[model samples]
Target: MTTDRISRQDARRNAIIQAARACFRDKGLHGTSMADIAREAQLGPGQIYRCFQNKDAIVEAIIKVIISARVEHMLAVNHDLVRKADEFTRSLAGIAAFDSRDDALLLEISAEATRNPRIAQLVVEADLNLFEQGCAMLKARYPHLDTIQVNALSEVMAVLTEGTLLRRHVRPHRPIDAQCLQSNYLAILHTLFPDTQSNNTRKKD
Candidate 1:
């Protein structure tokens, strides 16, 4: 009930989530157990259970953290891209370079979502949050576009970004060319905003 106690509780909960993420990345969702997470966090099962009722609760918390971070990043990138389209392409390239562990963890969560009703609901809620934030960013940038157009554009962007993440996990060995990534992103931007010019202007020799 005290502030210090609440802070400690939150810290412990976050530690559990981090441990669960690492364990999930290495052993996968089905392979991971609450005992594995407890060992990874260096905490006893009692402590973990004090914070989360079960592994599913921990998984839901992890999904919330991951999705919240992603939504924040996407909102920031969208704001910058409105000012300069080059930022958009650069953001995609940055995503293309995420750590393999992150790819694995996300893929694992996605796979689990398909079979688990609770995880499926969490994923759907997270996705809706993302879509709403994306829609707001688009509306702010392109006020001229109607609601339908903005929604469609946001959906396209989300699909493309998610696809990029999936591709990295599914084909870890395939090298993504920075130039091609940028070019493809630019093409998408150009299609969406035909009047806007990308800041990148390297003349082809």
Candidate 2:
């Protein structure tokens, strides 16, 4: 009897998680309700509430899922990316696109943070952690760039990318795209490290 109860509970929990992810993506964090999640999961509202105390809990869970997916994708960077800045940019940009669900939740989370101090704290911490990771990557590839320079560049990239994403998503027909972004970033890189240009590097093939 105990084993059967645990199995049922696990199933219900997984169902809610899966459903919440879909509902959150389809409906922004504010737009989604517990009832919507229940319908998505084919469960009753009580089932969602039983597993998650409230709508905030569901949003937190969805963000966690999306965050985990992003972290994993970021970890998959190719160390052999020294000769290929464009490839590295694509991999870095891919961290956000691990799933379309990520972009949806991130935009909503940004909005939520503006209204809630606790949520704002989470966003700050998460962005810092992610920026640190990006800085580490920069260190690995371009050890010549000092810590201060790395942090500065990472901050610039983070803000620019976020703004670009917001514009792209909210205005899908917008002229901005990742290629344009890469070109702009490369220009920055060229100015920042003129010494590292392809002509300066004997390794360029």
Candidate 3:
């Protein structure tokens, strides 16, 4: 295809994905239809169809966008996490705000995944990909950790992240103290990594 045609296709795909996210957030997966997405995108149903085979394709695209964002954040972390422990811990605690539109959309998709086998598979695959990426980051930063430890740490982080996301839905109005959040994350980091010098000093003082 010509360059202009490719650009138009890309633009349409993005519009469809953005529209799908909003619809899924508002009406959920099963409730949202192609017509709804078309209206949201301000495009005809045929145009949306030209970009994606079905709603599932748009959902998959949305998952990819989420993965890209998360992986980019992971990549931005310093390799020497021990030395940057305070900074890293604070970054983790910053997630406590839980005001992300993407988080809401993911929660909706996760709920739908439990009942839809195809969606469950896609979610599982995306989760595994994220897990592997996280593990790779951990291994690079802490080469002394064995594979089991690295995997366990990655799983713990995943649990913490998902749990925080769940809390966002259950208690959206709850206010979390940033200082307390940082302290709690610091404790978790110290416990998991087991530094005898700096972490212990901070814990004591």
lDDT (10s digit) by residue, model 2, range 1-205? 6999999988898789888777767776668888998999998888778889987776666667666765665667433233234643454454343454567668878887888776777777778778888788778767878899989977876775565556445654434366776776677656654557456567766
Structural similarity to truth (TM-score) of each candidate: 0.83, 0.68, 0.84
Runs with alpha carbons beyond 4 Å of true place in candidate 1: 82-100, 172-177, 195-205
Runs off by more than 4 Å, candidate 2: 1-11, 79-97, 172-185, 189-205
Q: After superposition, how far is residue 182 of candidate 3 from its true place, in Å?
A: 1.3
Candidate 3 lDDT by residue in tens digits, 144-169:
78899999999987886677666655
Q: What lDDT score belongs to each candidate, Candidate 1 first?
A: 0.76, 0.69, 0.78
**Would you list the clashing residue pairs of candidate 2?**
none
Winning model by TM-score: 3
Alpha-carbon lDDT of model 2: 0.69
- Cα lDDT tens digits, model 1, 15-62, are 999999999988999899999999999999999999999988998898
Q: Every model's Cα RMSD, please?
A: 5.5, 5.1, 4.6
Number of the top lDDT candidate:
3
